[model samples]
Target: MRYDLDTRNRALTLLRDGVSNAEVSRRLGIPSGTVAWWLHRDRARNGGLPGAHRSTCHTCHGDPLDRTAYGYLLGLYLGDGHIFQSGKHRVPNLTIACCEDWPGLIDAAEDAVRRVFPHNSPCRVRRVGCTYVKVYSKHLDCHFPQHGPGKKHTRHIQLAPWQREIVDEHPWELIRGLVHSDGCRITNWTTRRGKRYEYPRYFFTNVSDDIRRIYTDALDRVGIAWKETRRGSTPYNISVARRESVQVMDVHVGPKF
Candidate 1:
């Protein structure tokens, strides 16, 4: 095809953006066969298409703080690496230990914020040796009681409002059957016998009886065997004592009966 350099590059940009050759050909009034040839030639010369060659994974030698990649990463995390199914593991809240294990997790998180709001950038990413408990108080937990010593971690993903709305609207249509789970610590300090006291906490989820009943009914209809269970009014309930407390943390609902 004969065209100006700018026009040709524009077409190439479309291809880089994931438009297939057939679609590009139709849009640009070029033959599909010619588009295919150009794609092959571009790949041969530049190693790969623009975004294709650029590692989608932040861990793959790209800047962990790359906003665009991190925004996508946050979505993946919020979806618990997948959507609408049982998660392989529980979600965990932000912590020094978790960050250490993932290496550049903070960078990716910060990048996500920047990518979402390019004009208003804030440096929320930091390398802290201490965790929330250490910096704040031992009794501080985020939302639920599933936190603290001897408790399993709950993974929490920061979802944008729109993303949360989408998930909320299609509670059953989560594509991969899982969403990221995490933990948060909400500190409730106390004073005992004129001395300060701290307590570790944890959380668990209590779905509604209505939802459970519906689930069990669906299972029964599908000939699946499942034990019936009771439900509670609140999704998250907390049981507190002198030394410790526990709260509802995570809940998974799907139609895989």
Candidate 2:
């Protein structure tokens, strides 16, 4: 039921632009009551009531670094990261769960968190077989506009203008992040005309159509070609099996390690 600052701001903006609360709620997937409450609160604050003030966070300010860090974080978030408000105080926490087998990925995620929020420290939580890199910050939601309730596939996913700018500028970093989280590089062996051959390729799998489109769009931006592979049902896979396509992916995404 907790809404991020970005969501609240977006809802308020839409309302100011003459959008109905029900329409905004339907579009943003926010409850109608929440929208009404926000509008009422805004009106009260504008009325100059005592102790009625707008909340401000780091996002109200500008980003410290360029979009590289944010692009990487966004990819990771779309793949395996999650954000939620917890505790009695309702503090927002961002957690990126990476497989323990990939220590390098864990390290990379931690490094990105540090670079994105130098003031906040990230912690690691060890589950049964996965390690979660977690950070507590209100501003985390600002960087990831795609954060919302339920599974990503069931919800709408769209990149904001700033996010698009980042991905456009550094598609490789975005690809690296997505590949490290949801994709893998492997060597495939096959027999062709009584000959055994080995080839290297990359595979990406996700259930969210929007997320899959984002990944494919990034690949297209980098001039890498990928094709859809039938993977049973639900989750879909994108494979880069062609030699030239594999080469392009290798140059940008490389191996997760």
Candidate 3:
């Protein structure tokens, strides 16, 4: 029953903000006893209530942004993430839906969010077939400007200069995140002249033209070649089937679990 640092910090913050223990528990979906225990422990350590006195603590704030972290988050956001504001709250919620089939990607997404916002606690909720990483933070909007009213392709999607710099510096990492969330690496077998041969390739499918373009642009920065194709009339596909390109992608992205 050991909660992580982010969870403990979030519970404390909610209590400090005058939220009842039950409310905090409900919001975070943790046991009420755990919330009460954490608050009691904090009060015992401090001479007064948990939030009664403020002190200088660096750990009480968010972590500084890094290229790899930002790039990964951006790629995930572009792929399976969405930003929405609840009817009752003004602050926006950033939710990334990860398939339960790939627990590693879900863990990676959770870890990336924790690294970027060390002080804020991201909650994980289980659905029928997928898990969602949800965070309520205004700072999320600053990082992902792609948030809008309509779908990604219907709206404008552009990268800020700083974001561009990060993508330029760490294209491989960005590509890894993008492919991990929306693309897959698989072995394709074909029979030619009664002989069967297998080759490894990568494919990324998305409905957002802009997002696909950003993905391809990142690949281009890394000198990896990709081709664009369409499945029917809606979803666009980007395939990297060349031996050299596949090798490059394998080195960076590997296989998602």
- Candidate 1, 110-133: lDDT as tens digits: 454345333333333244651111
**Cα lDDT, model 2, residue 255:** 84
Q: List RMSD in Å for every model shown.
A: 17.6, 14.3, 11.7
Please give me the total number of clashing residue pairs in predicted model 1: 47
Error of 1 at 55 (Å): 6.2
The superposed Cα distance between candidate 3 and the true structure at residue 116, in angstroms, equals: 0.9
Kindly list the per-residue Cα lDDT of model 2 for residues 1-257, writing each as its tens digit.
Answer: 78889999999999889899999999999989999999888878685456544333346765465468767877888999999886664668888999999899999999988877776779999999999999887666777878889888899999988788788998888888888889999999999999999999899888889999999999888778788877665559988898998987777678876
In candidate 3, list every pair of residues with a backbone clash: none
> Global lDDT for candidate 3?
0.84
For candidate 2, the 10 contiguous residues with the lowest summed lDDT are 49-58
Error of 1 at 97 (Å): 20
How does candidate 1 score on lDDT? 0.38
